[model samples]
Target chain A: MNPLLEIRNLSFSYEGSKSLVFEALDLSVREGEFLLVKGPSGSGKSTLLRLICRLNPPLGGTILFQGSDITAIAPARLRRSLCYVAQIPQMIDASVEENLLLPFSFAANSSKSPPSREELRAMLRKFYLEEVEPAQSAMKLSVGQKQRLAIMRALLQDPLLLLLDEPTSALDQESAAMVFSIMERLNIEEGKTLITVTHADYKPVKKRPLNYMLDNRRLNLLP
Target chain B: MNRIIDISLAQLFLALLFILIAQISSFIYHLGLNRDITIGTIRTFAQLFLMGYVLTFILKSSNLWLVLLVFFVMVLSAMFIVKGRVREKQIPYFIPTFLTMLISYFATALFVSGVIVGTAPWWDPRYFLPAGGMVIGNSMSALAIALERLFRDLREQRELVEMKLALGANYREASDELFRKAVSAGMIPSINAMMGVGLVFIPGMMSGQILAGTDPLIAIRYQIVVMLMLVGSTAVTSVVVMLIVRRRCFGSGEEVLLR
Candidate 1:
């Protein structure tokens, strides 16, 4: 089967910088595949995901999402189908429910109805955030809780792929385990494709995930 | 009405006593502001006198093109001042920002002079120049504050903005909160002035008119029009500048590109 996402000869550099972050990089992920890219700090691991999401324009390259050039896609539409969650989860100065419903408020997602209160509460429980009240101020949540809440918020968008950047970096071991377990269920049970970038030693026990190391502007497959 | 009393050069020179008093206070307290005080005093005298001469020439010429040329210069100066104040190195916002300011300032000034004040020729330098200058001057500082707030907030709130973009928000939707805050920052001073006008303090224009021996009631009327014109121009300029600059904050892909 053709890959669900294909990146061909991706290249990027910071403005006015001499060195390239990614030079002639290539990547592909099959449907329902979980990709784990590990690298040291400043290795451009996060930038890889950003490039895929088109948050940072590539110096030269093409990103094909399901065989269509992502550049041809309306940014808002492309983003809706491929949601990205940052390492440091940011919550608006509003209630948790409002934050969760933010994507639906966007015109690109306007066609989809927002999740109902029951559904939102159920999602919170599924994400092990049962204690987080929908009406509670989202900004007041702990970092770990915010991270989980951020994931839950992304899931509400019903994206075709989820790009998570250091999702467990700020969490305690227990919370990290909970996040991993959530990732496991999402991949194995729900068949949601995931591309997570982290420097942590996280591996799912239930299934082996395709792993790569990003170093020196190259992605090398790890045995 | 009695002709307005004119101060001779000697009397004007005596006004330096106020600066002398300030300089002495600076010296006694070791405030280290004597140089700034000196430069400020010099600039005040030189710039005002220069402006007075220019106004006299323009008034005497009474040419519409000349009037517009002065306003153009004022707007251009105001644009550069805003650019200096904003200090954003990454985005090249100069041309768009200048156009926004120029259009809004001219529109506001023309409306005030032509419709509100009812100047005979509408481009009459006597009315148009001051009106245009006031609009540009007030809006210049306001635009600076607004642009500064915008760039700073975009940098500071990069994560939030990116988060919104990642979740399928367009540029406008992603930076909506920051945009509103920036525009508000630009307009708040004008709004506050409105709240305090004719109450806590008489404004500069009103005071000048009163000092020139105009009837207090007529001076109040002009002050009211000037105050309202300022608020309107500030609002329009801030909104327009922010709208244009907000696009600069994002990229063609609708990404937050502040850095």
Candidate 2:
């Protein structure tokens, strides 16, 4: 089967910087695969994710998502199937219900049926969230709750792929473990693809997942 | 409707009572009986009373030039308010604001008075003055908020926008999120004021006309027209100013000076 995503000869650099961040870098991920990308600071791990998500145009490279070049795709349509959760997700200053329903309100998701209250409750509970107060404001939520809320929001769209940047960076060990377990379950049960960029030891969840390390301007498959 | 007394003295007392309450509340907030409070109160009374007498004369005489002069002065003051409120003083702001006010207010005022209402002179003080004030008021607020929001969003979200462009979103799409947010914030006040007008306070225009002994029905019709004009001018001014400023803020290569 064709890979779900493929990055070919990706090269990028800051506008005025002489040192190129990456050159001739290639990477691919299959459908339903959970790819944990590990890299030290300043190794362009985030940049690779940005390129795949088309958040930043690559200086010289082509990114193929489902056989179509991402650069050539309409943004809202492309982003509809691919949600990127920043390291620090900025939840809008609205009620939790509104924030969760935001993606549904976007023109891209307008046709999709809204998740019923029962489905929302189930999803929240699946992520260990128990509250269902529609008026509970997002600003009052903790960072871990916000992150989980964001994940639940992405999941609501039934996105084909989720690009999470440091999803567990702000959570406690228990919360992080819960997040990993949730991701693991989604990978196995729902066949959802996840590309998570982190500096943490993802080895704990790599037992049944593909792992790669971005080092010295190259992405290499890790043993 | 008959729950209240209908005497003219009673109505005058009621109006005076409300005004007195407003002044006293303001004084209380500023610490009543202080020299600053006393001076402000005197100035407020003097200005309004003087304007009330002057406007009576202006309305009766219907001098077109005098009305135009007042409109011009109001627009100039609005421009200064916009400049003072915005943090970035380096921008040659007078141009955009003046242009925005002129276009938005004149277009709406001329259309409402000349084409719609069919004012004989079209520049009659009775029609032009109030219409001009309403349009200028709305555009003033809209321009101030829109410019501030655009500049602020560019400053704060420069990186996010850059990230979007890097993501292959064009400058328009990359800044699209911020653009929507800025426009929304700019219009929220006007929208809310509109929604809560009668409930929160009888809007100044309608109240002024009612107090001046016009039929309440006529006052309400004018108020309704003023509200529509305000909303229209605000929406137009906001979108236009943003479109104009967006060009200056970003380069052809989709590069933006966010900072």
Candidate 3:
């Protein structure tokens, strides 16, 4: 079976920096697979996530998504299929519902109707957030709630691949478990692909999942 | 019509005496502006004197080309000044900046000269050059404000823009909100001036006309027309600049071009 995303000889370095984060690295992610990448700080774990989603363009080599070069795909089309949730989540100044509905307001997602109120409530409930109202201001939410809201917002786009950076770093054990369960449902039942970069411990909800570590600018599978 | 009185050379020198008083006070107070004040006073004298001759020659010539050449020079100088004011030389600002200024100022100048003023030979230097100068000069200042705000916002709100892009937004949708804020800030000064005109302040154009022995009512009418022209030109130029800058802020790949 063909991989959903293929990275060949990828290399990257930030501007004005002498050190290279990675060079001549290769990676592949299968369709509907859940990938958990673990690495200590400054291992380029977050940078790798950014490179996959095209937020930070790769300095060298090519990233192929679904058998097509990402460079050749229209950016709007590419982003709609691959969404990235940053380590420090970004939120709009409006109500939580408005923030969630923002994707549909964009012309790129104009054809995708926004989730209904009941559907949104159900999604919120899945992450153990049962009381977050649509009209409640998003700016006033706690860091944990905001992180879940960002995940929910990413889900609203109905993307084929979800790239999350430190998805559970901001949550406690219980909340982290609930969020992981939601990710499990999305991967197993809904057949969505997920690539999460985090240093936190997670129990697999399905049969043995793949785990990898980035060291010295190379991705190596962990036993 | 009452004949306007011209100040004698002594009276003009009297004006310099006040500037001398300012220079001496600056020296007494240990103010660092002593050099700037002296240089500014000298440059003002030299520039106005040169402009007086240049204006006289341009008006005397009936050739439309000569008049347009002078107008073009004025617009170019204004755009260059704005570029320095914004302090953003890295961005390819010259093309969009110059194009917006030229189109806005010249279009307004033509409408005023051709339709409203109905001057014979619509490109008549006497009527169009001064009007073009005032309109283009004000538009330049307004555009500087908009461009400066845009540069700051693009840096500060980069995360928000990237989030929007990740949410399946096109560049235009992501930048639409900032565009409104920047353009409004640019147009606020002209709007405030319009609101206070005749009530809290008398504008320079009207004052100049009145001092030149024109009837106060006619001067007020001209001032109204000129103010409207300035407001329209500023609005158009500011909008155009923001549109172009917004597009450039995004890369060819539809990602936010974070510098």
DockQ of each: 0.91, 0.06, 0.70
Candidate structures ordered by DockQ, highest first: 1, 3, 2
TM-score of 2: 0.62
DockQ of 2: 0.06
Model 2 lDDT, full chain set? 0.76
Model 3 C-alpha lDDT per residue in residues A1-223, reported as the tens digit of each score: 9889999999998877877898898999989888889887999999898777677777899899999999898887788899998888889999988998988998788888889988988888876678898889999998888888998898888898999899889788887887788778888888889998988888886745578998988889999
Better of 1 and 3 by DockQ: 1
Off by over 4 Å in 3: A16-19, A172-177, A205-208, B16-38
- Candidate 1 lDDT over residue span B1-259, tens digit each: 6478899999999999999999999999999999999999999999899999999988888899888888898899888888888889988889988998888888988998899889899988878888888888888999999999999999999999999999999999999999999999989999998999888999998888888889999999988989889998899878987898899888889998887
Highest lDDT: give the candidate number: 1
Candidate 2 — which pairs collide?
A: A54-B167, A55-B166, A55-B167, A56-B166, A56-B167, A57-B166
For candidate 2, lDDT tens digit of each residue in A1-223? 9998888998898666878888888988889989889888988888777666665666898888999997677766777777777777666678878877777765566788887777777778888888646578988888888888877787778878888888999989887888888888888889899999987665455346778888878799988
Give me the displacement of residue B213 in model 1, in angstroms.
Answer: 2.6
Question: What's the true lDDT of residue B158 in model 3?
Answer: 83
Candidate 1 chain A has its poorest 10 consecutive residues by lDDT at: A196-205
CA displacement after TM-score superposition, residue A68 of candidate 2 (Å): 0.9
Q: For residues B147-172, what per-residue lDDT tens digits would candidate 3 score against the true structure? A: 99887887899889888888778788
- Please give, as one word, the docking class of candidate 1: high
Docking quality category of candidate 3 according to DockQ thresholds: medium
Best by DockQ: 1
lDDT by residue (tens digit), candidate 2, B1-259:
2143345856655656655776688677875545655576667768778767877988888878887777777788788888877767434456776777777777888888887678988887778877887788777777778788888888788766653443334567667777888887888888888899888889998987777777889888888888888888888888887777776676534556444
